[model samples]
Target: NAGVTQTPKFRILKIGQSMTLQCTQDMNHNYMYWYRQDPGMGLKLIYYSVGAGITDKGEVPNGYNVSRSTTEDFPLRLELAAPSQTSVYFCASDSTGFYNSPLHFGNGTRLTVT
Candidate 1:
């Protein structure tokens, strides 16, 4: 089964545009997350879902939104894209939120806003 898959490996958006970064997992995990990383920096959580119909904003949720309608899918939305939002976006999932639970990550979506 595909652990985690993210579409649009790369994207270039003009200012004020909007986009959705798709993320799907087949692991039936209860916890899913979206994170973004700027060049040469650690990743920062943008949004997360504990389970279907349950979601919450993460550390940097200002320009994004997320929804988890099922255990296998969690999609992130970006509104009014800006240059500062240009970064490598990663989708991750884990069976548990514990520190020892292994986190599976997508290849990453590289977005560039001009």
Candidate 2:
């Protein structure tokens, strides 16, 4: 299984710009999630999807959006990038029926918005 994969491992954006962070998994997981990790901080959930066409906002969904149209893809979009949005973004997923299941994270995309 390839787990999760994110593109553009690093990025620098100016304020007000927009970008999409791509996420894909080959493990055929039914639950996928997007999270942001500020410097020295724990992961904060941004959005999640239980399955295709079923998505929900999370703790920190502001300035972001997500769509899960298939079991293998769940991409996150930042509408208007801000410095406060500058953080390491991670894409994760886990098997269904395992509420306590640990997430499989991608390498992470380090974003810096100035």
Candidate 3:
């Protein structure tokens, strides 16, 4: 089964432009998340959803938004992209909580906002 998938392996955006990073999973997992990883650091949670139609903001949710209308899709929206938002974004899923389960991650979307 496909765990999670993210599109646009790499992208370069100018300041103020917007883009949505796509994420989809086929594992039927109840938990989906969006995270950003800087050049040399661990993943920082951006947003998450417990299930369809229920979304929540995470640690670094600023300048970002998310929608969970379907179980398989949880796209992250960057309304006004800034240089500070430039990082590798990853989509992950977990059948259970972090304490009991490991997350499955996509290759990642490398975004560069100038």
Cα error, candidate 3, residue 113 (Å): 0.6
Candidate 2 on 82-101: residue-level lDDT in tens? 99999999999988838688
Top candidate on TM-score is 1
> TM-score per candidate, in order?
0.96, 0.95, 0.95
Prediction-by-prediction clash tally: 0, 0, 0
Model 1 vs. true fold: TM: 0.96
lDDT of 3: 0.93
Worst 10 residues of 2 by lDDT: 94-103
Worst 10 residues of 3 by lDDT: 94-103
For model 1 the local lDDT of residue 15 reads 97
Runs in model 2 lying further than 4 Å from the true structure: none
Q: Rank all candidate structures by their TM-score, best first, as comma-separated numbers.
A: 1, 3, 2
How much does candidate 3 score in TM-score? Answer: 0.95
Per-residue lDDT of candidate 3, residues 63-93 (tens digit): 9999999999999999999999999999999
Instruction: Give the runs in model 3 whose Cα sits over 4 Å from its true position.
Output: none
lDDT of 1 at 7: 91
